[model samples]
Target chain A: MNDDALPPARAIEFWFDFGSNYSYLSMMRIEALATARNVRIVWRPFLLGPVFRQLGFENSPFVLQKEKGAYVWKDMERQCRKYGVALTRPSTFPRAALLALRVALYGANEPWIGAYCRKIMQLNFADDREIGLPEVVSEALGSLDLPAQHIIETAQSDANKLHLREQTEAAIRRGIFGAPTFFVGDEMFWGNDRLDDALDYCEAMSRRDR
Target chain B: MNDDALPPARAIEFWFDFGSNYSYLSMMRIEALATARNVRIVWRPFLLGPVFRQLGFENSPFVLQKEKGAYVWKDMERQCRKYGVALTRPSTFPRAALLALRVALYGANEPWIGAYCRKIMQLNFADDREIGLPEVVSEALGSLDLPAQHIIETAQSDANKLHLREQTEAAIRRGIFGAPTFFVGDEMFWGNDRLDDALDYCEAMSRRDR
Candidate 1:
C-alpha cells in the first residue's frame, strides 16, 4: 500500500527532539515519505528536558536503564545504516535541544525549518557535531539562506523560549512519552517505525471526513 | 520486497515475555506472517523479573513511569483492535512468567508449544484470566490437547526451572532489554513493529548466503 506514493491532503503533527537518535531516524526520512503518501506534516519541535522533569525522571530513561541505553546506541547505528543516513555516535548524547528547538519554534511556518532540522540531525548523528553550540545552530541557519542572526536573536527571546515550554507541556498532556511521536488529528503514534501507520490513519480520516 | 512470498530457507529468533501486552501482539501475528514469508521462528520465552531486578528496579518500568504505563494499556487496546485479536486487559499486568516460562522451556522442542503459547496469551489478554494461577495455564494447555499434568509437574522440576533461568541470562547477555525482540542472524530488532523488518533481513541474508 505504499501510502507515500499518494496525494498529500491529510495532515499529521510530528514531535521530535534534536538529541534523540531515534528522532533522527524520523527526521531523515519523514518528509519525503509523507510527501510521497500525500500527507502534510506539521513539525513541532520541543525540549525533552522539561517533559522528563515533570515525570520525575532525573535522567534519560536510556541512561537510567543501562541495557536499554546500550541497545539504543546499537539500534541507532543499525537503523542509520539501514536508512542510508550517515551516522557517527556523538561524544555526548541527549545534546542540548533547547537552542535548536527555540529556532525551530521561530521558524515553524518557514519551509527552511525542515532543512535546518535535517542539518542539525546530520550534525548530531552523521557528523558527530555538537549541536549544543550556538555557532553550530547559526551555521545551520546560514546555510539555509534564512535570517540566521535575526532568527537566533529571536530564538533566545523569552517569548520564544516560553513557547517551546508550552509546546512540550502540550505534548505531555497529549500522552507523548517518546520521540518521533505523530498525531493524525488527535490520535498519536510513537516511534520512527510507525510513520507509515500514522500517515495511513491520516489519509483514511481525510477521506472519511470529506 | 515481499519477503513473505519467498522461500523459507531463513530463520529468525523470536523473544517474548508471557506477561507483556506487546509480546501478545507478536505472539498473535508472527506465526502467520513468518510462515507466509517462509521464515522459521525460534520462539524464546523468558522471564523479565530477573532482568529487571538485576538492573536495580523493583518494578516494571512501565509501572514506574505512570504515563508510559497508561499509554501502554491504551496502545494495547488500539493495537489489538487493529490486529483483530480479541483483547481484554488482565486484572494483573506482568503476571508472574515463571511457571508459564518453565513449562515453555519443557515444551520448546514439542510441536504443541506454539498452540500452548497462543492459548496462554488468549487467557491473559483476550479472556482477562489470571495467568499467575497454575490452573489458568493448565486450562490453556488442556485446550491444545497436550499433557497438562505431566508438563506442569515437570515444569516445576529443578532442571526445567534452571533451564528457564539460564535462557533469561542468555537473553540479558545478548543485550535484550525488551519483550518481543527479534534477531535475524546476529542483528537484533526490538518491539513488535520490527518483526517484518527482521524477517526481511533474514530472507535477504539467506538469499545472499545461497
Candidate 2:
C-alpha cells in the first residue's frame, strides 16, 4: 500500500512496572519481538503498588507467597539462562522503582523509551543496582543521550506525577492486576510467557483488518 | 539400543489439582504432547486447598484477589479458545475435588490415570458438571471401563485418603504453590503455559543422560 493509503499500524499496549522482575524480562525483549512482527509498541508505565493493594495485599504477591517467591527467583535464573540474558539476584526484592517509573512515564511515547526501559531493567535485574536512587535513573537516562537532569525534573513535576497516578488508575480500570500485561485492543495477556501470544494476536488482528 | 541395554524412558512429573482450571488445560493436552515426544508422564495428584492455606490464604488466591479472579476467568476463555478447547465456565469455581483427587491419587501409577484425570477435568471445566459428587467421579471411571464402585471404595479407603494428604504435603515441601506444576527432576515448572517447557526440559535432560 502507498504511504498515504496504508492502514493503521498494529499496536500492542505494554503495561509494565520497572520493579517487577517479570516486567524486566518483557521490557528487555518486547522491542525486538514487536519489530520483527511489524507491530507498534505502546509503552504504558504504571505502578503495581496500587494494583497489588486493590488485590488485597500491601506487598508484592511474591513476598506474601514465600514458596512461590523462592520459585520465582529460581525460575528467573532458568529463564534468563534459556534466553541467554544476564540476571543477578537483587539484594532487595522489588527495589524502589518510583523514580524510574516516573522517568519512564515521561518518556513513554518518546523514541528512547525502549532503550531507557531496558537499561533500568538491566540495572535492577541484571546488574542488581539500586534503581531507586535519582542518580541511578539519571545514569540510565544519560546513557540514552537524553537530557538526564532536565528529564528527571520534568518527571518529578506535579503534572507528570499526576499523569503517572492516572496511568496506574487506568491500568486498574483496564483489568490489569499484574505487570507485564499486554493488550491487543481489549484482549489482555499477562506475564512474560504470553509475550509471543500477544504479538501473534496483534499480527493476526492486523491481517484480518487488512 | 537393545531392550535390555536401552536407557530408562524420559519422564516428567505432572503435579495437578482436579479443581484447578489451569490444571484442566494441562490435563486435556499433556498426554498427546508427551506421547509425541516419547516422554512419560508421572501423574501426581495433589490438593491446592492446603497449599493455599500454607501460602497464608484459606481460599484460592483467585478468590482472595477479586480483580485477578475476574482476569483469570476471562484469560481462561481466551486461552481455551487459543488452544481450541471447549470451556464452559463452571457454576462453581474450584469445585471440591477431594474425592476425585483421592481417586486420581489411587490410580497415580496406573495406565488409565491420564484418561481418568482428563475426564474429571472435562466435567469440571468443560461440562460444568459437579465433579465433587461421587456419581460424577464414578461416571468418569465407568467411561474408562474401570471398576467404578470398587475404585470408589478403594479411593475412599483410609489408606488412600492418607496417601492423598501426604502427597499434598509433599507438594508443599517441593515449593509447589500452584497447580499444573511439572518437574523434570528438581526443576519445577508451574502453570499450563510451562507444560511444553517442562517436557522439553525432560527430553533435554534425558538426552544429556544418554
Best by DockQ: 2
Model 2 residue B54 lDDT score: 85
Q: Cα lDDT for residue A88, model 1?
A: 89
Residue A124, candidate 1: Cα error in Å is 1.4
Clashing pairs in 2: none
**Model 2 chain A: worst 10 consecutive residues (lDDT sum):** A1-10
Error of 2 at B158 (Å): 1.7
Model 1, runs deviating above 4 Å? A1-9, B1-9
Task: Compute DockQ for each candidate against the true complex.
Answer: 0.58, 0.74
Q: What's model 1's TM-score? A: 0.91
Predicted complex 2: DockQ: 0.74
Q: Name every residue pair that clashes in candidate 1.
A: A3-A37, A4-A36, A4-A37, A5-A36, A7-A38, A8-A38, B4-B37
User: Which ten residues in a row are the worst by lDDT in model 2 chain B?
Assistant: B1-10
Deviation (Å) of B71 in candidate 1: 1.3
Candidate 1, residue B206: how far the Cα is off, in Å: 2.4
Interface RMSD, in order shown: 1.7, 1.2
lDDT per residue (tens digit) for residues A19-83 in model 1: 88888999999889888887777878987877788888776888777878877887777678788
